[model samples]
Target: MRVVADWARQESWGVRLEWGLAGARALGPGSACVVVVDVLSFTTSVSVAVERGTRVLPYPWRDGGAAEFAAQRGAVVAVGRRSVSEQQPWSLSPAGLRRAPAAERLVLPSPNGSAISAAVDGVPVIAGCLRNATAVAGWIVRQGWGTVRQPVSVVAAGEHWPGEDLLRPAIEDWVGAGAIVAALARSGAGPLSPEAAAAMAGSVGITDIPTLIADCASGRELADSGFAGDVAVATELDVSAVVPVLTNGAFDDAR
Candidate 1:
């Protein structure tokens, strides 16, 4: 199967473009695998959780329905937010998430990532970030072994939309996506779409990975809000090889 670079560019290929998580969620259930990218940190959080051996339960930021669902499944609920508010000093950590009681949960209300997951319910969802890009790509390739087609959608959780400024988010997500595409190509999965190829090429210009991340809109927002360290940590690739797979609305290691 072919890959769609950004949702916006999917229209010509008869693929629907999902603007935000809401749009993504509208794409009902199927055999497709939705890969969500919140390059700034949320995706990083999922990678971290998987690496630490904690299962991730994703939900829509606006709706808390996933929280109850996770509780029923005996998984922790994690929250994602555009910026950390006073109410949420620490977004759930991988270690803390692992310690959550069976009936307990971590709620994620991040700016971009969590919403991406909420949009595509019932579809096999995977978390993607620069840090875990290679691992996740490897997992996808393995999953596609012997299959005629692998339906995969890479959702770029760009910065808050309609703001018009996209330099940081664009650069961050393009780089992350590029790494994944490279990994997939290396696995003999075939070539990426032209847009994907361009993104991969663009990632090379980011000489200072950490600095680039920190300067991103989301990164700057997080840093200004006291989450600067998180930005740096998020930019690191392959820090953890855990590939988080979303099953029935929760994220678990893809054993």
Candidate 2:
């Protein structure tokens, strides 16, 4: 950590693509921005909500109080994948959120993405995914983050195995993070670490994102859970202009 912390401070626009909370710490307090990529649902859900003119509050999934937290914030809570129905408009299902009526504010609790985003304290956190990767990168550039000075950290919110305390590498979040990395590289926004560079290279061959993601382990798991549509929505590239910026503990459209 001392080595990583030292490395982060050396560059004018240093960026290290890392997973979970460790990534946030590596970038330290001087980071221009922290982009949280949870492509399977969380960041994609943020895109949908922000596009619909709703602010999303990323609440970490705790014991079962997300509903109460939602009530406290005067926002609707998103249910689990299987618990969603027409009446429960807000849910983790990206497809369901797209079709359901939008609430002015949505409180979404997730074990992966939301938790990672919430853990990154004292930094500007923005949700990014395939749907708004380019736009998010563009916004970062426009704001002079990782451009004129300061650094940015792209945090990939990887999936945790069932009943396990460790995270399994997820292809979807990797690819999603790569999408943003590639965009940032093209803009010459900052210096990319080897891991971020490799991620960008991996994304270069993705000619058919939806097809590839459809067969990934997470995709298959979601399909088994009757949420295949969520995968499809997550693969939509550069179609959304909304960049969900988190400030004061809520995500609203950056534009």
Candidate 3:
């Protein structure tokens, strides 16, 4: 297991890319920062919440435990998209969070992005989305991460199959991660692993990112369920200057 893990680490490269919670774990150790991307929503929602002055806590599950977790921290727990109401507008939907009143703190739970964020330890965890990709990359470069001595890992939080833990690699997340990787490269971060390079290449020629995101499987899933607004919010590329960085188990604006 150790041998397999070491081989998968991509440790020789300054920038590495991998998928889901397990990917976060594999690349987390010794890395200076781990960036988690979930465009069709978790990271996107985090960007919105943090931009609104909310400290976002990444909780791994949306189960009842999330309520207790939020209670312990005196924070509100964001509900599922379908569970959102006028009285409980805070949800994983970026659109919902955009319209919700500003919160001092929020416990945002999800199986993908939030789970990956919660799983990474001993390094800075950054929330990266289309909205803040350039900001995130600039922050990472400024911190002198993504070098041979201090590597950076970008983890794509792909969706899980309904009623199962099986991961379905969502294209929106791939491109979202790609946006960060590409930005990092442009910011002078180097020696990208093949996986990271592939992710960067994946985002390269995306002329109409909003339309691409809206037509993707994950985007369509949200759109078909009457949450098209969420997709719209997630596709606002480079519009945000807030860099949400996890410190003390909560994500807040770093710049």
Candidate 4:
């Protein structure tokens, strides 16, 4: 094997906050657990689907043969947020999923969150969003990661820049992650890392979440694209009791 090494490895053994796949890999190996925050709208959709009694299989993307992936598992693949119809019912809209009849499994695809999720295996992963932040954190604690005080990595699945490979950090996801970090510390799961602490502080800095999220870059982008309802649904706080944990590569209600 040819010797090939590059970036310096910065690993975390305590609660840490990281952005995107690089962070996920840095903190994932042998870590206690991971909380993937993808507010618009992978985890949000997961929260919705799991709450409605359906398992979500997060495919890497809608293209790249996602249909084949779903078909192989006998699951229904979700289409674009606005692509919903009587024949094609599932979509990326959290609110719409709430109204749709629950299915056995759904192949939810996304460029950010699902990719992050698919990258991490052998570690307990929970889909975190504004709607279910508290519940997910509380669930992590109840799993003994809190009492024993193991490291919990909060990974933000950020948005990609338009027409570029670079990931753009979305304010909504930062705030959503902040909510989870704060909840974890509040529940005495463990003390937050400096980065995580700052994120939690940021989450607390915003009081008017609905208004703030609506005005954010990602939010406005979604709104401009006619997904305002999705932004609204994702901004709801602590209204969910469902914790979508990945089991055997599929997210299901672990509550």
Candidate 2, residues 1-255, lDDT tens digits: the string is: 245756544354455587865665666466778999999989999999889998899888765888888888898888887787777868888898888898898998998889888787787899999999889998988887764256778888898889887888899989999999999877777688777888888887789888889999999999988889999999988999998999778999878
Task: Decide which is better by TM-score, 1 or 3.
Answer: 3
Candidate 1: how large is its RMSD? Answer: 5.6
On residues 110-195, what C-alpha lDDT tens digit does candidate 1 reach at each position? Answer: 54677677556566777888888778877887877212244445666766655653323455765676677667667765445455
What digit string (tens of lDDT, one per residue) describes model 4 on residues 1-255?
Answer: 222233322233356788997778777765688899999899999998987789999878735898889899988888887788887788888878887878898998888999899889789889999999889988888877743247789998899998888989989889999999989988886656778888999999987988998999998998898879899999888999999999998998887
**Better-scoring candidate (lDDT), 2 or 4:** 4
lDDT at residue 12 of model 3 (Cα atoms)? 90
State each model's CA lDDT, in order.
0.60, 0.84, 0.90, 0.85
lDDT at position 197, candidate 2: 82
lDDT, residue 247, model 3:
92
**Candidate 3 structure quality by residue, lDDT tens digits, 6-90:** 7899989999999997788888888999999988788999999998999999998745699889999999889988898777789
Candidate 4's C-alpha runs over 4 A off are 1-13, 146-149
The whole-model C-alpha lDDT of candidate 3 against the native structure comes to 0.90
lDDT of 4 at 36: 95
Candidate 4, residue 20: Cα displacement in angstroms equals 0.7
TM-score of each: 0.74, 0.93, 0.97, 0.93
Instruction: Give the best candidate by TM-score.
Output: 3
lDDT of 4 at 199: 92
